[model samples]
Target: MPEHDDAKADAKATGAVTPQGSGRASKRPARSAPAFGAFVRKEPVRAPVRENTQANTPVGASTAQADGLRVETAQSWPADAVEVGAVIEAYGLKGALKIAPHAQGGKALLAARRWWLLKGREQPERHSAVRASAKVHGDSIVGQLAGLTDRDTALLLRGARVYVSRADFPAPEADEYYWVDLIGLDVANEAGVELGKVADLIDNGAQSVLRIEYPETGKDGKPTTGERLIPFVGVFVKTVDLAAKRIVVDWEADY
Candidate 1:
């Protein structure tokens, strides 16, 4: 995973932002994300699987029709849905798509059976049941949607952003955590001095780094801004309690 260089202005500080497949759980120093996608689920919140009914047609079936397509809006999206990648182009003579996965890579996409696609920011979003998906060379993904069978149809989907439900994401291993889960957790040193909340994380070849944002106080006792880039290794990150939304580290705020 590449580092998120830009600070997220709208980073969810507190909420049920469980980890999806894009990021791996942080445990020890030098702990790398698995070759496949890594995601974690906070039990009891299963991904919603709405069956097709007369009152409500399946999302894909309805979106196929021009009239149904107009009804799509942000409100129709699943609460757990997270953008994972985008369709860059059509692949092969057969109906297949080339995907440019977000920083987390295609692990979550590979594990998902269905995918949501959006053409543009304000455009309606639609779901496509996946028939097959595979990781390919160049850190990309090649996938086949159930109803698509020709290159022409696949080309039409180019530039569409892909999203997967967090509920559908597979669980992480012991001591592992999803990146989403750590984003808003509070950070404190061993002495109990408040540092800041996690702003984001980035992969620095060997390990993930936590970008923390705290407040800097001036000589007059006015609060300013402070940022810290701490390595997420076990050496620095002593303990992580997701339920408590707190992380105890070995470093001090001034350092």
Candidate 2:
């Protein structure tokens, strides 16, 4: 989950925002994001899903068509939805929302539209449904919704999470992978020595690193778990086979 402790911090402290499948979690010192794609806020929210873009529409007069029959259907959050970001503040005088994404060193939230507003970890199910029509600002994203207008309404959303169904994520290009996709694969070395399974990953400014966790049986014959912080760069990582659920690296178990 994204750090909610700083959710109420001023906008000036807004740093690099996370993008879906584009960034990892932060476990080390992370650098600010470079200037990525920024656009003016005037477009629609829904990015065409390769699977079914129109299938998961929201209910509203916004979707109502001419002759008053129908248009799009509003979608609720999926059970396995992944928490992507949090509401930072309202942008402009409109219903635009400012978000701090959880994908460390990434800008994945910029591509998200349909979002569920959860009031922190205590609020299990979503409390509200809103569509996002946003643009990338400095290090965060500013967006707007149909019913959500003015700073007062935005205030009600502070610290609320943004989630997209796991199935809603777009397929990555070749060689690129989603952080969620690599979460559970096994890790090994060049010589076929088993290391551990992927517990998590982090963004250390320069690149993404893998946090592989496994059981280590020490010389005392006692078992202890350990974590390996392997750089996800070309120098350390070799092949990542999602189909095989394994990553073959140029690293050693002892290292």
Q: Which candidate is the best by lDDT?
A: 1
- How much is 187 displaced in model 1, in angstroms? 1.0
The regions of model 1 sitting more than 4 angstroms off are 1-72, 217-223
TM-score of each: 0.68, 0.66
What root-mean-square deviation over C-alphas does model 2 reach?
Answer: 12.5
What's the count of clashing pairs in each model shown? 2, 13
Least well predicted 10-residue stretch by lDDT in candidate 2: 35-44
Clashing residue pairs in candidate 1 are 25-177, 37-107
> After superposing candidate 2, which stretches have Cα over 4 Å from the reference?
1-76, 104-107, 128-132, 218-221
lDDT (0 to 1) per candidate: 0.60, 0.55
| Residues 1-255, model 1: lDDT tens digits | 222222122222111122222332475444433222123221121123334232122334444443212234467677888777787766788767777766444556666777778764554546445545454435566777765666755665666777788776556545556677788999999999988999877665445678899877878899986789977765567788889999888787668
